[model samples]
Target: MAILATGQPNLEAGQSQSLHYDDFPPLNSCSKLKIGTPRLPIVPSLPNERECKIGLLRNRHVLIGLELQEDFINVMAKNIYYLLAKDGYLYTMKPLIYDAKFKVEEETTLTMAWISFPDLKPTFFVKESIFSLATAVGKPIHLDMATINKTRPSCARVKFQVDLLANFPKFMEMETVNEDTKETKIERVKIHYDRLPRYCLHCKVQGHAEEECRSIHPELHQYVARD
Candidate 1:
């Protein structure tokens, strides 16, 4: 049995003041009873009420009784539908996508590829040179260009620090000027992104996957089932 505390002064301390229930035993079950904090005032039910009200849930719908003279509810409902549509739920026309709220937002260290095709020049893979390319998307924290064994190293590794708000781009384009004409030419370089060893979608943290997440939420199952 659960014991809830009320502000009434006559009730004994640590004693439950609930109506007598038939199932309740004369003695506390296991000689232990759960007690909650002090009870707050009742929530206001009408709009235009200045007083704050605790949120109430009825049939999975939240009712706070806030005042909004405009057609805000309809617009908010449409916005919610669009957000769900991105997951391929009501509208199956578009591909399924994850909501932005579930994205990982930590500063991740990633290796980016800087390549100059057809010609592998060691000068093109210098630390200073790759730093400029990494700066376009992220902070150029470090650079490593000593992995090449060929006469000309077309590919270089750049240690880029970035926050993965969404999926990172696989390919990147860099421009190089010709020696003879001095004209600029664009080179399509590929990015060798590193995946985290484990990622927890429920906690939005690395080093532990969703299956191993300790603080998993009940609503996570609903989102997973929808996906």
Candidate 2:
């Protein structure tokens, strides 16, 4: 008697469709499989549009926040670069204006004195005299001038005077000579008090201090020593 198993295909049909053992021994079931070349990962480009939008938003905010006067803002903003390049300081406030008389008085108090030169041509002689006098006393002298009249006039005379009392005794010295003696013998002389030895203040005393003055300050009696 013959017996048949269930769900099994006929052996002759299976052999006709499958690999033949004699032909290449049928590829091994556990052989390594090779895949095609792998594809590289893709990297998206940066979003330039988003960056531009952000920049635009920031600029708008700055413009909106700058609530300044139209003209002033325009001047400052438009000229800022040029002004910064040219000037050291950013802003310049208004300057204070005062009368010329006040200014002149202030200057005079700090200055020696103002010399008047009526004649412009003779100014050379005046300048020479000032230079000589200043040099003789070893003091610095500065010359300055101003116009008296705007229009033309007749004969012009240069009247120049120095502030001999500017530096007080420092720039001047006074000396007195005694000519009472018959033979013109050396007698006692009086030297003036001065901050410096100039033509304004000088002492010419034999045995006394030149700073002693009875008219200026009587309390300075201690400075006078009688022999």
User: Which number leads on lDDT?
Assistant: 1
**Each prediction's number of clashing residue pairs:** 1, 26
- TM-score for candidate 1: 0.35
lDDT of 2 by residue, 54-152 (tens): 111111111111122222222222111211112232321111111222231121111122222233233223333333323322222333332223232
Tell me each candidate's TM-score.
0.35, 0.15
Q: Runs in model 2 with CA error above 4 Å?
A: 1-125, 136-142, 146-167, 170-227
Model 1 stretches with alpha carbons more than 4 Å out: 1-121, 145-154, 178-182, 196-201, 208-227
**Tens digits of lDDT, candidate 1, 44-138:** 21222343233212222222322331222211211122112222332111111112222223312221223222332455555445555454455
Report the number of backbone clashes for model 2: 26
The most accurate candidate by TM-score is 1
Clashing pairs in model 1, backbone N/Cα/C closer than 3 A: 120-152
